[model samples]
Target: MATIRALVPTQLERRMKTPAFGRRALLAGFGIGALGALTGCRAEGFAPSAVPNGNIGSNLNIYTWGDYSDPANLEEFGRQGVQVQTDSFASNEELIAKLGATRGTSGYDIVVPTSTYLTLMSKNGLLEKLDLGKIPNLANLDPEFQDSIADPQNAYAVCKNWGTTGFLYDSTVINRPMNSWADFLEAAQNEASNNVSLLEDPAEIAVIYLAAKGYDPLSTDPKIVAECADYLTNQLAPHVRAFSSTPQNFIIQGSMTLVHAFNGDARRGYLEAENPERWKWVFPTPTANRWMDTWAIPVGVQHPDAAYAFINFMLQPDQALKDVDYIGYSTGLTGQRELAEAAGLKMLDVLFPPAEILDRLVSLEITEASGAWVDMYGAMQAKAGA
Candidate 1:
């Protein structure tokens, strides 16, 4: 299938020379100006047109990705007179499902939903309207991130950290070069057959198949999604050894030769691995799912003051740098990105990438096909467990 190419941005035009080169950790990345100050890459200048007065208070109960938020940040938040507590989920879908089931009665003052999930959560009246004045750092965000079409006016969610999904392979285990989706699927069924692992999220894997076959990942077509499910269960099931959102150990410790992992997780695997050179990340050409994990408040927030305070505190450039460094993810906060660079954080660009890539980057969201996607994942899980 011809790769889905979008109209090029000049910034990406310069980057197109080595667009998908994700091999080496030290490859100098094209400047995105997004995190560091390039046009269309930076998130400055798009903060709220007006600020709202938000009540200040102490104590907050937050929910987020299992390892996404740094514990130290929480400790510091506690020290600020706001007693802070946190719970976490493995995936955004898990977080949304659990929170929706509870209807904010769970008493979580804050929750982190990816960009795609934010719209639904907000529309469902699950999230509270954010007071931009309370979050002064919104001005620090790249204008691109600040003006989210999904949560227009920044009423419900403020995207803070973003990353992409792709696979990490142990070069020592699989001798051949694996770049495209075809190469990955081939390895799964043959050389690395039944020895590979994939992320448990159905959408993550489905995006790969959709992109490879030139179908939009965001399509709500039942037939198309059902086909994706069939492909996941029949064609990819036998080759999967395990399915996990947290596949860090599988890739880092050599339990699985090829682990479908987030860009940050795979980078973490490489950084923590005993044999770092043996592990490598691959971002499929034409497209990849670029998602933003955002901070939002539950409808009936227990501590509005603390929630806003905590969000602003995290937006502080130093804290944002620490957050990204610990998680191995990238943020669109230009200030934070520069700090990471000055601090010599390696591969920050690869995890983040130039803004041009965002043009081809797909945003996977809840759609009419959600049910089919879930059923498809259930089938894949059943087979893997069997």
Candidate 2:
């Protein structure tokens, strides 16, 4: 068992600073200048001609993950003579709630949310449709990214990066071939007893429950989701060690025998733990939901051109490569294949798992833009928490 210490950003600030490195990355990160005056890294200058033509808002307020954007990235925008500031959110739900409360008057220019949430926001008219013509770098995105379920038409948002969720288990504790989500739940039930932990968030739990019941978590039916809620509370709740919203540190200290974890976190854990084989990953059998983070221009963004410039610039092969390395996820950039190989990242199966295995994975998706489903999912989560 490992003690899991998760690095969750505070509810107030909801972000942490990544160490600024790489010459080009440093320059690109200059986009973070307006957020703070501190200079961490510098990148090539951000410049674009397609500044929004009509009724664009002046204040470039952005809401995103703390580490996703930095002082340097802000500084790059600042250099473009755009006024920008950022607010961080810990979860997609929090950002959704904020956007609703502000009612499209939040004065934010950009909002980066997970792929699933992009659908919800787009349906609600919270996101501004991207003018791809202005973002020529859209061409640089990998084919997998260009083809997304949430934004099928490439209209609402753009994929930034993607990763997966599963369990990081101690291979020696109860050695057997661990292959799927069901195996993890069974082991958590048998090995950890009441100490077994799962992700505390409703969205993930709902998805896991659906997987357990052989149903898609993104299913829109109210009755089916209710069935999922009942299934989780009845079957797995007793074995749960803890419903951890953040479980990183627990795994680190050997307090967690099995953890529902992200692939990147699992990789970091394997690297940090002295016993390399002690930590291993499990990709669900049929499929587990793939996670993606994306970028969107808010409705009132004044510096849409700079924002597009930044996105296109980020689409550059080198920029995407740096992001993949720094963020610990596979990006939708064409160059990562060679870059990851050259960087020896291919050796990390958790990062670059076997081709056949990845083919079996599925990204969670919304069946329809329905408030009823969201409410149903939310209710199921509340029950799981109880």
Best by lDDT: 1
Query: How high is the CA lDDT of each candidate model?
Result: 0.69, 0.62
Q: List candidate 1 segments past 4 Å from native.
A: 1-55, 91-94, 97-104
Error of 1 at 342 (Å): 1.6
**Tens-digit lDDT track of model 2 for 15-125:** 122221110121223123333322222234334434454222234567776556435445654554455676666556556656766666766667878887676677776
Prediction 2 TM-score vs. true: 0.77
Global CA lDDT computed for model 1: 0.69
Error of 2 at 70 (Å): 5.9
TM-score for each model? 0.81, 0.77
Q: Itemize residue pairs with steric clashes in candidate 1.
A: 33-37, 33-38, 34-41, 34-42, 42-142, 43-141, 43-142, 43-143, 44-142, 44-143
